[model samples]
Structure formats: C-alpha cells, structure tokens
Target: MKHPLSQFNYCPLCGSAHFEAHNEKSNRCTECGFIYYFNPSSATVAFILNERHELLVCRRAKEPAKGTLDLPGGFIDMGETAEEGVAREVLEETGLIVEEAVYQFTLPNIYVYSGFPVHTLDMFFLCKVANTDSFKAMDDVAESFFLPLNEICLEAFGLDSVREGVKRFLKR
Candidate 1:
C-alpha cells in the first residue's frame, strides 16, 4: 500500500516542492516549516434490526463498492456527534428516521476514494426506528432490504471494516 500522502508532490501551505516525509504519518515542507499529518476520519455504521430481528442492509449505487452490500451510515461531518451522524445517514440512505442509536463498537478501515486510501475510524451503532413503512432506497443506496442474521454472509459485504464489524456484531 502507498503512503496516504503519496499523491502530494507540493506543500499546500507554501507551494513548496521541498516537502518530504517527516515521519510515517506526516510530511514536512523544508521551505515553509509546515508539517502535514495523516489522520483517520470519523465514520459511522448502523445495525438496525426489525421486530423479527432482520438487519437492514443496502446495495451501494456508487463505487468504492458499487452493487455490493452495505449498511446505512457514512462519514461523520465536522460539527456532528456520532449519534447524530448515524441517524442522519440512516435517514439519507434508507429513508428511515432513527429514533435512537446505541453505540456498539469501532473498527479502523482504509476506504479507497478516487484511488486515494482514506483511513477512517468506523463507529458502529445499533439503531432503533419507530416506523419502517416510509422506508425507500435513496441517496447513494440502490436498494434496501432486511435480511435475517442467519442468512447474512460476510463476503457479500464489500467494505472490509463493515464485513469485520458484521462478523463481530453477529458474534455478540
């Protein structure tokens, strides 16, 4: 795997070509004395189960993992809490308003976006919804459905963190 900052050749702070690796996770610009560190972004995932205990799942409409199975969550925005981000993501992708979200676990993942590896700390949540009647696939989701826990295959999930997360979720 390439370094997360491998795509950069110039320093954004001073437009300096003297930028070089400062350490494993940072780069220093020799001309401007600016250091850029690579850090993981915060993301969220939801494991919503209906009364029958079927987990809600989605089909991705876009890459990184087009047409693969996914959960209803995304990156947490700058000013949002993890609970708020998970709820918003559930609403956006599945049209289901989350009444409550309980934090479960977290997993570190490398999400490849536009050929760049983005490190993320994916926080998992077990969500609750008051109604499923309004559910419809929206946003980046191609379709949405619920599957029994026994029927879910880890390999069907495209994202590594999600796959591992689901495996851990099921075991618990």
Candidate 2:
C-alpha cells in the first residue's frame, strides 16, 4: 500500500534509491529495510525586543501568510542550533543583530498553504537587539517596524503563531 502523502526517492537509513511500498504508511528499501516517517520540518522563530522595549515586527512579503505582520524568525536549517536559526532568520528578514536570546516556547503545528501541508515544529525565542538603529528589512520582508506591545492587533496579522508568541512573552 502506498501512502498518498509519502514521496521518497531513497531509503533514509541506507541512502538507496530503490524502495518499495511496505504498507499504506511506509516504504521499504529494496537494498535495506528502512522506514521513513512522514513528519514536519522544524523551524525556529524569535520575538525581538529593542532597548525601548518595543517589539520588532515585519510585514511578510512571502507566502505561508503573505501581507501579514510576523516576528523576525524562520526555519531552522539542518545541523544548526535553535539559537543559531533564530539569529540567522532575524538577520535575514530584518537585518537586526541580536545581542542575547533565550528559549521561550515551542509549538507543533501544521501550516497549510495552497493545499500543501507544512508540518512544522516551531521553536520560539525572546531576543534582545544589539543595535536597534541598524535594523532594516532585507529579504522576504516588505517592511519592518517596532510597535508597542499593546498596539499589536490580531486582526492586522492573521498568523496566530506570532500573536501567541508575543502574547506569551509579554505575560512573562
């Protein structure tokens, strides 16, 4: 049986391209019996706070929720730590350098866009800006601004991941 969602060219354990459907939920390599589970990718995100205590937010220019406000964060690359991913994503999206950051929370959610399921283990962090004056939008970011926490509205940004992350930070 073939899983409707399973698509693989090789066995994850043996790196062999020859594989056969073991069942509706798994595949077995012809060379080695290795099963690959359909799972979500892990992502790391951050809620950056400047010296003035203003939360830094960006208007997303890309999908998965375009034209919406979000925190300066993104996917964690392979072999990269959560902290590293948070810093890199913040810089890539907002060009803001983070001075210090601490792990906040984790959310396991499915991001569905255009009929594609994006399973993500989202790791959230609280980051402090090293140089607030140098912050600027780089790529996949239409605009960036620091807003008072109280002014943040859920209606303006439909992404509950961001809203929830910030709200959690504020409460702590």
Candidate 3:
C-alpha cells in the first residue's frame, strides 16, 4: 500500500529535488542544504485483558495495518509520556479506559510502505481495563473485540514487533 505522503519529489524542507542519501538514516539536499532522516518515532501499545484472560484487539480502520488486528496504540504526541500515550491511544481506538499498567517491552522496527520509511520505537504495556462497559470503536478502528491469547495468530496480524512483545510478556 502506498503511504499518503509518498508522492513528493521535492524536499519537504526547501521543496527541492536535489536530495542525496546520506546513509541508512537520512537524506541530504543539495539545493537548500537540508538533511532529511529516518528518525524513529515513539509509539505506545496496550495489552488489555479481561478477567477471563482474553486480550482486547481492534480492527484497524486506517492505513499501515488496515483490516488487521492490532493492540490499541498510536504515535506518542509531543510532550506526552509513554504511559500517557498508551492510555490515550487505548481510549481513542477502542474506548476502553486503561488503568494499572506496567511497561512490558520495547521494540525497534522499521515500517516501509511505498518506499517511505516509518521507523518506530514501539513501547508495549500490559494494562487492566477500568470499565469494559465504556468500550466502543472510535477513531481509526472499525471494530473491537477480545480473543484468547492462544487464539491470536501472530502471522495474520502482520505486527511482528507487537507479537514478540506479547509473547515475551506471556512467557513471563
């Protein structure tokens, strides 16, 4: 799938096409002398489970993983802490209020769609839902439901980094 912002020929900084790859991390523009690099953005994910040990998963309503099951998460906004972002993303995507969470794991991965890099430093946390009755699909989510951990197919989700984090958490 093509990223929505992948059709640009000019540098975002100075609107020049005279750009050169500086390394695996960045690009340098010869025209306006601007450097563009693949900087890893921080993202937070939540593993919210019920008393039955079923994990809450949401069907993505947006790109990057549309139609696939994903743990509630999104980019950490500027000035927001990791914990704050995790809780906000969960509420925004699944309408589930999360409480009592602990950091589980951190994964570094790169997502490339249509040759554009989406480098992410993903932070995962295990949280308990405060009010399941409030759960409802919201922005960027088509639907939300719970599934047993063992029933979740990691390969089908297409989120290897998140799957690994869940696996590690379950193992411990």
Number of the top TM-score candidate: 1
The segments of candidate 2 whose C-alpha lies over 4 angstroms from its true place after superposition are 1-32, 113-115
Query: Candidate 3: deviation at residue 90, Å?
Result: 0.6
lDDT, residue 52, candidate 3: 84
Global CA lDDT of candidate 3, please? 0.78
Per-residue alpha-carbon lDDT of model 1 for 1-172, expressed as tens digits? 8888877899989999998999988999999999999899999999999889899999999999999999999999999999999999999898898999999999999999987899999999999997866689999999999999999999999999999999999998
Ranking by lDDT: 1, 3, 2
**Cα RMSD (Å) between model 3 and the true structure?**
3.6
What TM-scores do the predictions have? 0.96, 0.80, 0.78
Taking the tens digit of each residue's C-alpha lDDT, what string does model 2 give over 48-139? 77677888888988787889988788788899988888888888888778777788888876666676667678899888877888878878
* Poorly placed runs, candidate 1 (over 4 Å): none
Q: Candidate 3's residue-wise lDDT over 60-139, tens digit each?
A: 77777678877888789999999999999988888777787799889986665565677789998888878765688899
Instruction: List candidate 3 stretches off by more than 4 Å.
Output: 1-12, 30-34, 112-115
Higher-lDDT candidate among 1 and 3? 1
lDDT of each: 0.93, 0.78, 0.78
Give residue 60's error in model 2 in angstroms.
Answer: 0.6
